[model samples]
Target: MTARVPDAPPHRRQGFGAFVRARAANGALVVQPRMGFSDPGHMRAGLTATRAARAHTVGTVTLDSYTRVGDLDAVEPALRAGTPLNGYPIVTHPGATTRAVLDGVAGPDFPVQVRHGSSLPQHIFRRLIDLGLDATEGGPVSYCLPYGRTPLASSIAAWQECTELFSHARDLGAEPHLETFGGCMLGQLCPPSQLVAISVLEALFFRAHGCRSISVSYAQQTHPGQDTAAVFALRRLCAALLPDVDWHVVVYAYMGAYPVTEAGAYRVLREAAELAVRTGSERLIVKTVAESRRIPTVEENVAALEYAARAATDNTTTARDPGTDSQTYAEAQALVEAVLNLHSDLSRALVMAFERGYLDIPYCVHPDNRGLTRSRLDEEGRLCWAETGALPLGRLVHTGRRREVTAAGLLADLSYLRRKMDREAIGAPPGTELTGSA
Candidate 1:
């Protein structure tokens, strides 16, 4: 909501990447790049040209079929000495059927990450299948609508869309997990009241349907230059939004001039890490800092991450100290409220899920399109499906057990389940029995 003010304290204009390096106080240094200058060939050529050139030239590059043409495998070993690659393979393709094949090609440099999207919903699943083919493939992916409390009808519809997609994929013999986040992808972020409602749906609806991973794009929702307190407060709110799920916070630094100063953009990340710690979050995905500039060459990207790692230093925190002051709290609170109101408008999508008896778990396992999600509802039906015993997203055939996202809820639902095990614990017991609540 505000511009980044690195020099000013938290009370100031709250909120704040690429390619050149500079020195810091203790003989330390940093690097930032010129904007609009990320072409793969230009970058590669620049690498070849810079050593001999008499003058500087802003490199020019283009998307090689939308893929970066740099040889990251070759570049990484030399550049990343102390820093570790996320190791989560980001496979970029256009379909679902590739899942198996991709899964088949798994290796060391690329552990497993399925990055699929950029197509209409119909072909999305098929692309996923393809990804699955490779041994190195990760969760089959698709972009889903935003799951925030933005209250925008369009904002929340994707949940159902994904529920349906999951149903269709299941029938086709493709089982995949969705990538979820609090905001982005038409999803909404909201006040606690609204978040409560949304979380209920997140837990129950996702459970009833069949979703696995629920991600939180927390960085996208944060404002830069804001003091650490304010940043921490916003993170706390996000924590409140998804308390019951095994979620992750994606730390996206200022890849651009959206609202952060270079120093402030530098600062927002530490703020984010602090908040994540407060939330007791286990997983953290730090997006590349050089993204806003030209396409980072393998070395440059690695360098950018190295800088971020140092920038996000002193990351020792706990659940109690989310660490936000008053002004920061107010700013974060207001943002959540606006997003929550928008979520109300989007409730139609949530309600529709109830009416239809199922909702899509917008899990975008792919890192493509900056990690978006997609939902489906069989081969027909625009928004809603009119069939009996069928959910809005599509027909649901119990996966023999239950949905993934709701595993947490299932444990809660099984409050009585534990007691049954206890009561029948004579070394032999039944899977479903109740002695009380566990």
Candidate 2:
């Protein structure tokens, strides 16, 4: 037991899963992957593996923006082509009021591609309403788009775009939706006001836009010494505005991850689950493991979720008085103070990073988006385009610093984590105890 496993390879070599499991238990690493939101796509041979993950709850199934109905014809090719998170629902944009976006998984068919910089008739609203008649499977329906570039106007505009569509959907009896990687949703370079503004915007946007369903997201990432307080604030806000709207949280599982590496993602998992419970929303989306490093087979995706579900713990198990049930207000305040003190030390370092230029965001829209168009190669042997090739944003964030999360970095991560941890946003934390039945 003292010695390393005989044939352990370098990555798995440092120790075995047993070693990592021990570290995670000590609070050194956040174990138990929680609130997974995944978009599974790979070569033709990867379909069966995708279906296998039906066990874990999946919140968001990101898609290839260009995928259309015609692409699903080939069996092997179609498998490789992509599948829908739910059956691909028809999305429509009528008048200037509609801004349709595609997020979630593949297997889609759009009525027609709308060209940018092209003129459109105002009467398009009727066509859009007609198109959306049967788009949803009658469960719940919503919309999404890349968080646009430009700091001020764009962020607000993106928010407005959702409002318009949500209003349109309401006119026709459907809920409204909005989603994006956290950082991009707020402006990558904007101040905290912009970040805080996102929630406020969603609250107002959904109401004025006539939508009842609302969602917010953060990048799937964290650093050492996570700012648990900042995470708490974000969650509290969701609880404040959204007792009714749906909340979704997604965790990205990939290789070389920090939180996953240091704490094993369970720390964040519990946080997200806590938020979900506080918000009291019904469904939550969780991500799949085996996604950070390589193109996962469907089996690997399911295995990752199963592993997280099997290992996750519940952190909000404190006893509640039977007579006095709702302490939502008190709970919200407590979360804020808790996050502040917890992240006091960590926020400083990130502030410094912000002051300096170490963290420049090159990609404007979909900054942390990890959806790859397809797992393919191009001329001269290169991994698809650089954007699609290397680790995507979710992959990068989930893989936090290899070093321990300093109190400073923790603040930065917690800011995002707070938004990420809401239970409605993510989901209930998976059971911490092992199932013995994978």
Candidate 3:
């Protein structure tokens, strides 16, 4: 049975998607941080601080690990023992408590999103929608492949149900927004073309399941040039496919290994902001300098947000149109078309795509993943397919010069950005490899 959002005043505030759209219209990039605390007071304080930041910002209630896995029973024990969970335990906490957390903090100008890495999010969706909150992010494929062992078929079904339930928020005059994590599969190592393809495909899946407003995400990767082209392809494809849907592009700071140096961290973050600005992405998810060490304090998150905002402001290069003829665009479009041809039902098509290896994530160990595909960093630091497996790209991807990724090569590639940024931090000359452990 489908749960419904409780009654509310008509048009009480701006919707999440509407907020982002308005901010983007005014040429201000909306920046957000991935922050959550177990205690309601701490969570509220975090949101309040994020709201008070100098940049145009949004709020995030990232759920605790236990809640994300649907382990509600475990969350109760943690709460009772006063053990601080990694994130907010939305399900375990009473609705009134959550309301208290959001009250005054989330409003027309500052909207909040519930971000949980869950394959089964129906309960989370029901809780958020009931509280009059309308934005959250995840997708059947994106949440499943990277995070857990949940069968792909089950995840697809659960998301289909949740998407339909989330769509009901529009009836309350708020356009519920859903963002795809597909572009950030396994955090790193996957090629950009596949990332773009999965991002678009997941958006299509959401749209087909009843979500009207969406955001497609692309994570910062090995090469800025390739990342730029990937976001361009994502936008162009979304334009062509989702003409009637309200959509935008969001860029995540490099999701792989982080630089241990504060300067290195800031350098990566600044580049992410510049990438967002140069590509005309509407939003950015910022990471902090302490990312290499520990969960950042609220102050660190605020600093990162402000730093990213300043970076965006200083980048004078406006977004230029990346025409649809680029290699990334062609490959992504082909992958989308190939998958869509598999079955009329997007969910079934997704299952069949994986079953037949039409879609595969590199280095993802999920049982649903084919594990046949492999990717390597090229001499220019661009991600290339070392082994194409069964992807239907058929010469669309040139793997000729790419060598198989060795164990040592993979380790170095993972730390490629970390070493490069740490090198630049101390004004070390380019190509001078940083010595000693990461």
For all candidates, what are the clash counts? 106, 54, 0
How much lDDT does candidate 1 score?
A: 0.31
For each candidate in turn, the TM-score is 0.39, 0.39, 0.95
Model 2 lDDT per residue over 312-363, tens place: 4333332222221222223323322332333333233222222232222222
Ranked by lDDT, the better of candidates 1 and 2 is: 1
TM-score: model 1 vs. ground truth = 0.39
Candidate 3 local lDDT, 280-352, one digit each (tens): 8999999998888789899999999999999999994965667777889988998999999999999999999
Residue 408 miss distance in model 1 (angstroms) = 46
**Best prediction by TM-score:** 3
User: Whose lDDT is higher: candidate 1's or candidate 3's?
Assistant: 3
lDDT of 3 at 3: 12
Clashing pairs in 3: none
Best by lDDT: 3
